[model samples]
Target chain A: MVSSQSGRRSRRWKAMHDLSPRDPHAGALPYGKLNLRRNPFGELEADDWAALALPAVDLDDVARRLREPGFRVQFVGPSGSGKTTHLLALQARLPEARYARCDSGRPLAKAAILLLDEARGFPRGGGSCALGVHEKIAGCAMTVELGAVPLDRLDLIVRSRVERFRRGDGPVPEVCLSRLGALLERHGGDLRLVFAELYEDIQDAAM
Target chain B: MPRCDLTIEFDQGKRSFAPGDAIRGLIRVRVEADADCKALKLACAWRTHGKGNVDKGLVQETVLYEGTWQAGEDRVYPFSIAVPRGPATYHGHLVNVDWYLGVRADIPWAIDPKAEEEILVSWPEGERSPDLGPAFSAPAARRPINEAHAFVVAKVLLLLGLVGGGGLLWEAYRSLGGKNVSGAVQYGIMGLSLAGVSLGVAYLLARNVLAQRTLGPVRFEVPRQYARRGEQFAASLGFNPVAPADMTKAVLKLKCKEEAVSGGGTNATTHTHPLGEWVLAEEPRRDLAPGMGVSLAGRVLIPADAAATFASSDNRVIWSVEAEIRLAGKPDWKKEVRIAVLP
Candidate 1:
């Protein structure tokens, strides 16, 4: 007869061995020895981080949308197009909400609001348990179709929105194109105007 | 119609063997659904490369073995070829030993055919002959052995390409001094390095993956058959052919009214069609019933200019035409037409 402590230890051993990290659904995606640890954000300082991050767009409207459950949107662009950075900046405006990579080991039904970055690398075929959750939560995913918008327009829009948000007196619950046009000129057309007046509205409502 | 499909793998068992050592192993074969194939014969022999007088002059041996097999069945017939004696020898290099199976089908067509396999032979290191014999020496080297070093150097060029691509990406990032150009450069480098690592893993798995040899179902409808004369023959937008455009070669099925009524198999070929022609299979006669169906298959070359069109080509208009048609109802009633128009 085994002692209670020994029996508990045996159960723990069985559980750990059953779990593996190579399984994408249950394990980390095998990116295979990537040198991605370099500080990509090292060049930017902390205080300027907040100001340089949020484009001059109105955040109240965007914040409003995020509060309403089932709200979803995507920012499509090629690699280095700033989809993740833009999403992170958007997150800064929403202090209460939290984010995390959807865990691979747990059933997808067990998680909500998955953010797929390299969606092309998704596994082609897998068991039904993983598939069911993927379909159910697919709508909540915000994926950017790279190459949808030109880079010049994207920079212009990001800068203009930040300018308006800084002014703090644009259209309420709606986008104000006139103010966006002024901000576009202020930046001297050096950047692309991606979100323009609209992104700010979405952010303001969500915040 | 039931057909015989065979796969012959060249497994050069051991590095070396004595002249009389038994060359033994199972020759594997697979038959398709419901076949009335008669006896299958396995034939194997060694022959030197090239044409005429030099061919089969150094023949090792040729043997015919008989075996009876059925359809949907996989059978491995064990074989043992007695290594011949005399000055004949197999050096520790790839020597060709071609083997194929012959199956006689009950089908009326004399197509009852033979399947073949090319096996490679090599001998282990043992007694070194002071004078190299023609049998054991490498395939006659037209060029000196040193010539292969040049080919290896050419393959090394892939690395230069990788470095050049990386440098170009970095320059683009630096020129565009946006929010974080450095971050983009870092990610780009990481992605490329990861790809290299994955390729290595794929190379390791290739030895285990056997190549599959079998014909897929044939489509009866020829694409773009109604093309105006002078118009180029082209496949519809959604249908993607697996064959390369330049190597456009396809076997098309054709038929005539009497041929279709009697359930006969007939086929015909069309001269290569220029890229732009829209081809559609046409009925042999205009008076045919509306419900009648026919089949055809053939290769058409997509014009070289097709790739030069607007960035994606899908958005551009084509000005050339070439066409071919196969009507099952009329085997001999085949047509190949062409069309040209101002851009």
Candidate 2:
């Protein structure tokens, strides 16, 4: 399994090498924005995509999870945590994808995958609504997150509201949280168990 | 977190005292825990309340203590403030003395907490000495009468001219028997009436315009109460020294008139009356404009010890001493006065 992991890493590195600039790390070093290409709403011109540096994430698995129906995923942690990286990686891997910021208590409609990065910055009980979107596109190759996610592990124990909704333990609507949990579990890959532990800590903090 | 408390006290119970007293005080500060601390400063400030008067208020400030204290230590700082001598009154009264201590912190964006004590001062019972002898209590300031006088005179004369013209028109209508006057006699009468109106208007305009250009509008203020020439002085008399306090009850009245009207000092004109052919030269003359108040200015050099009455020359000019209750308006003391003999 270790050799396979290394092989997969090598293959990923090789695939990036096939492009003009082999060392994706050059683009990855959070100098400015890394991945976001054109605006999702097609508002941006073609040349706007600066560069792309994909992190290790189970993109196909994330797609499958999103396809399961009623898909929802929330990214929670301090600023610059890998939550955005994971979500954006999943977005790029999917065939049909839509991106939006979630706020207030509103339903996520028509969107195949509901990815909310920086969920902690949003107010509590604002419901779920993306008040406005600048750009959106259909029939596109992939949409990348335009910023860096820190490599450091987030001490997710502080996010109590997230954990409460995850275990079916709190007054969360059964439909929304369960779907979000399954979606998170799908893309979480090796980090799934760690997320589970952090989720438990969050529950304790809430209690 | 470390905390510090400060307390201050003054020895002299009074804040403002005689110029020779020493301001005694104690300042104490108690710190709760051991910590890096900075210096403490004790300051006594003196500031005037009503500054920028004809006589400006004075200020004297002094710094009494400056040093540092160890954490968890209580320290008492003692100091004194000195009052200077002379005609100077602290502020307007005697003195307003306030003292305070500031404990500075090493951290930026933090203000040093301070303790303050405010006190009033006392002066010697008889020490109040104002520089000037009572000229008169400031007169009841009058609403400026210059513009108003011009307006009134113009309206009055205009009304008089209109009335005179109406009378002449009535006479002409009756004499002409409803037919328009067609001869030289009819023309002559009309010409005379027109000339009369013009002369009256010209005189009115000249008087007002000259007054405005020369000494400006004269100010006449009748005292509310007027004491006869031999009436008992100061205490025994019921007269307002500045302006008549009881103007409604004043015995004397005020009247103004234009006389010896003419233009001079470069701009001069001579015109002959149309009906009488009397040639008059418009010479510049110093006289009150009609409807304007009288202008009076004199320095009464009374013997420093007693009040005295003085007489004025040019007394019989009938310069109307009508004790009317008109406002004196503002006075321009800086403007030179001819210093005519007192009436």
Candidate 3:
């Protein structure tokens, strides 16, 4: 499945290459060259999860369990640990599941499978359901703990996106990659913040 | 109840007058019971209403009659007052300047019976009061530029430059296989250099063309064109970038300012004081590829105790939305749209 997907992506890249300007440096920057329909660094919608390429993580298993009836699960992690991403991914996988923020005032009893985000703020006795939170609740049937993204994993994510714009030929600039690594360390492994800062640097460099 | 009823009527039943004209009117009083009428006063004044705070200016006042009143007495008093040669009447979004002729009968130990009639004061041809200033004057209509047409033209030029430059390089490559290897190499080198330079130039032209094509016109969609004081205002901004470019930052802001003229005649200096400001959007840099545009929504909660929108001849409190877009290798684009905030 990965091979076929890569093959299709390569073909699309070839088509874009042919339409690009002759000057190699003209369209070299990734700013105006990426897919315009979606923002890679910010929040992703339900349909965008299928195309996400990141380090190996077992979110699919959690997603599958979240679909089952009466399975009260809680995903606990620090900020920017992809907890929200996983919850959103689960929402995509389980179309029948109802999703809401902790303060949304949605009646949990009405939903066959409820996905509550920011569950730490949720009041007690709101009925059992899956929750995405920074800390585990006491009575959750299952607790899924996510750790901070390592610098190597962050590097892979950045390389994957940069490589897409380069059409798999040239290496991403060493200075740019090094700067991103430094940012990861400076931000204490806050992956989302690191990405935001990296995106700003890229935008500035392109300008 | 008042012992007498008073009414003021303008001459010739004309409710409108120009500056420097005489305001001729009659005051009529009907005495219903025996009462001590101290004085009959006629006051001419101009006042503002609707927003901010009320402002009033007395044009003229006079005592038309003074004496005791009989139970069945009726009196009509005629008076004439010269309208000031300045300060023409104005109507605006949050302010209005109106003139009135008020007649009041001072009845001792009872409610003073009073009547007021509104009168319109307008500017004569080629005679505008300097106090009215440019802010109160009606804005002239402007013709909008057709940006889409300009975009198409820029795109076409870019395509032509790319095609023409590519053809030259292809032709130069094909000639490299000919005899006289060194000569051919020399000729090819020269052709390659020329093609390289031309391609570079063409690429820059195309990039600039795309930049121009994609950059503006920014549109601000305000939820309400008019707002009450202390009410939150929201607006959505849409920026059309026909070609890809890096957007370093985008921001939305709301500001209220007081503009006034100080000093007199030739030494008059206009001053502006910022009353309040709110930052609506301050986003990190992002890439906007070709065919990509930006649509962002933002809101600002006007301070509950903030000043309302007000305008007069010499003073004004204005509310506006300022949107700024920063693009790579191009000048930042900024625009402001004015809105009304009522009290």
Indicate which candidate wins on TM-score. 3
Lowest lDDT 10-mer window, candidate 3 chain A? A31-40
Residue pairs in clash, model 3: A32-B289, B214-B242, B244-B290
Per residue, candidate 1 scores C-alpha lDDT tens digits across A101-157 of 233232333222232322323332221111112122344334333333333554454
Off by over 4 Å in 3: A1-30, A33-39, A53-57, A103-109, A121-128, A160-176, B1-343
10 residues in a row with least lDDT, candidate 2 chain B:
B334-343
* lDDT winner: 3
Q: Residue-wise lDDT of candidate 2 within A42-144, one digit each (tens)?
A: 1111111111213434456546755765433333333323344455555565536544434333444454455553343322332321111113323222332
Q: Give fnat (model 3).
A: 0.00
Query: Which one wins by lDDT: 1 or 3?
Result: 3
DockQ of each: 0.01, 0.01, 0.01
Worst 10 residues of 1 chain A by lDDT: A29-38
Per-residue C-alpha lDDT of model 1 across residues B141-230, encoded as one tens digit per residue: 223223235334434544554565566556557645765766666756764664464444332332111100011112323344222222
> Which parts of model 2 are misplaced by more than 4 Å?
A1-207, B1-3, B12-16, B33-39, B46-67, B83-109, B128-247, B250-343
lDDT of 3 by residue, B112-195 (tens): 999876677765543422334234332123233354554465566556645665555555556555545566565556656655
